[model samples]
Target: MKKKSVGIIAEYNPFHNGHLYQIEESVKATGAEVVIAAMSGNFVQRGVPAIADKWQRAEAAVRSGVDIVIEIPTVFACNSAHNFAEAGVEILENLGADFISFGSESGNIEELKGIARVIEENSEYIENFISKKTKDGWSYPRARRAAVESITGASAASLLDSPNNILAIEYIGKISNALPVTIMRTGPGYNEFETTEKFASATAIRSLINENEDISHFMPEEAKNIFLKSEPVDKDVYFRLICHKVLSADSTDMEKAPAGGEGLANKLKASIRMCSNLEELSESLKSKRYTRTRIDRFICQTLLGIDREKKTDNYIRVLGLSSNGREYIREVKKSETCRLPIITNINKDIKNFKGIGYGISVDILAADIYNIAAGKDLYRFSEYLRRPFCE
Candidate 1:
């Protein structure tokens, strides 16, 4: 019998205790023998560099508990929640996953499904409402929440207030081939910087890392050792690069950015001149209509030269694998359910990505740039030189 495989969409920025809990709980809940994680590479959805690069993070995840870790290409991984969730679901489905799991503030899967259904049913109305509200100087999240409230009532709309709940709704909305599983998120909130007895938010862990504080208690021993040996990518390291991109970019060039258009390019150009640092620059661009995350994403997209139109077909690019993961891949590849080409090796399997080169190119570029940001020389074709981490 084929073992049940469950999929997780994660950005294990440092593979903290919370993530470890999620993996264990997800496996317990689903009875899934093989766990696959589609993790963000180099940069996360929040539009900042990860604490460590993709390989280190993936290795930590595999060593901790996850059976397999695959890279979520930079284009979708660093974009909006919808894009992130949709791409993750697609990749997991392509990998022949029987279930998709995630951490959420509300672990009630039925409630989440209800909310997703309502949102899908009212998408057009919500979009129109969002358009009207944005014109009235409201942020996208606030507008969308209000729109949802108008249709589903305040009780249901309030669910979207939590970050994990928001993602839960997106994951539920996007899943077609796999079942949805939600593990109740414990400890501090998503962006919370507080440390609890057993769990700490990734935000808190990253802050601790940035401050050179001990995070030994917050992460698994293997994950901690991996993180301890590596230098975390400092967000400020890319500030100068961002400034250069913004200053040197023409109106056309700015419009090419993933977050560009609607005069935002001009706003970024103007803000870059007066701001002394990345935080100040982001603050200067912040408004009711544009959240800090949106601004940060724009800055990252600009820094990496990722454009709005550079979409690519989805492909599963494995970053790390455990023994069970290798066996699972071997079995899954022989089955008709595996819909996408799985590239375990970049050097020899680069040909499998012929038509889907755009996403891979973006990932390579992001990694090379991340190397520079991490104070490493740009090893030409680093993507090709690196191999997937195997247990």
Candidate 2:
């Protein structure tokens, strides 16, 4: 029996066949007895509510062969890629994972690691290079890629061309200890969507679902069932709510948000006055200094009341786990595998807490907002009332 555990971090926006492939490959590659997943709660790194809630996604992961599934926290889940990777790394480290695996466009784990090392070693030089590039009208990501090319080579910069490849570098860069594994990405590109393809991108799968197309090929049965039944978040309603929040907030309130600062706040207020939807709002505010994804991050942070100096709650919120996962947790608790308090039920420890100082509280707030978007109030689906799903 393999003694080691492997960790995978993902949004699993709706766990699909690609996710299942990663789960099996991670085990085969690492010979890991347990596969622990650090998942985004209600919101994803792309600054949007998950197609299904966190519980549904976690349960899907467990059914698809992940042993233990934990929340990656709202503060990290809905932020930029760097923050997302850093938070995921920290949680897996806490879980005592011996290996980490991720899907990447480049499919070269060693090359990515080499690039990560070069970036880490020349952090100061990179920062200066990025500043120069950005000043000359480049986006932060573009600037960073060019800066890396200046140090390593063109191939190293090419690694950042795709979304998954960018995430791979971040995952490897943040690794202080765990062994890294890379699975070559197959099928359409991360942004490309083809519902007819066997390995459709999650983006395509989501679009197919949105169009009410049968996605049985892309998703597992359990995930497909959940996706079909779960109340999808009403983006229109949520966008209206955000517009109201932006239109009503004064300069002082916007300044306090600190996500976009005073200038971003002004732009947000101006954008909401004209735009009726999230897409329009983003387009209205998009500029040389900010990419669409950057705008989305700022808007999400602003809407969620996240401040500049984000605080961490330092708690492990277990969404769900399988029988093997439970056994694995028991082992971790017996030893020093995980250093943080493992929270299984929010109703007990997290629900009634009046203070917002708890790190998990942010996740709770995000869930409640999702509840609102999902047309639930005082519903059992609230994260507060959720008990760990054990299979």
- In candidate 1, stretches whose alpha carbon ends up further than 4 angstroms from where it belongs are none
The ten-residue window of minimal lDDT in model 1 covers: 231-240
Give candidate 2's TM-score: 0.94
Query: Candidate 2's C-alpha lDDT?
Result: 0.81
Question: In candidate 2, residue 145 scores what lDDT?
Answer: 84
Q: Pick the candidate with the highest lDDT.
A: 1
TM-score of each: 0.97, 0.94
Give a tens-digit lDDT track for model 1, residues 123-208.
89999999999889898999999999998899988999999999999999999989999999999999999888888998999888
Tens digits of per-residue lDDT, candidate 2, 1-391, equal 2248999998888888888888888889989999999998888887778899888888888888888899887887777788789888888877788999999988888888887888889999999999888778788888998888888788667877888988998899888889999998777878887644567888998898899988888888887887788787898988977877787767556655434652778888777878878988999888877788878877776677776564665567888898888887887877865766677866676654433354676777788888888897747767767887798
Error of 1 at 147 (Å): 0.4
Clashes of each: 0, 1
Query: What residue pairs clash in candidate 1, if any at all?
Result: none
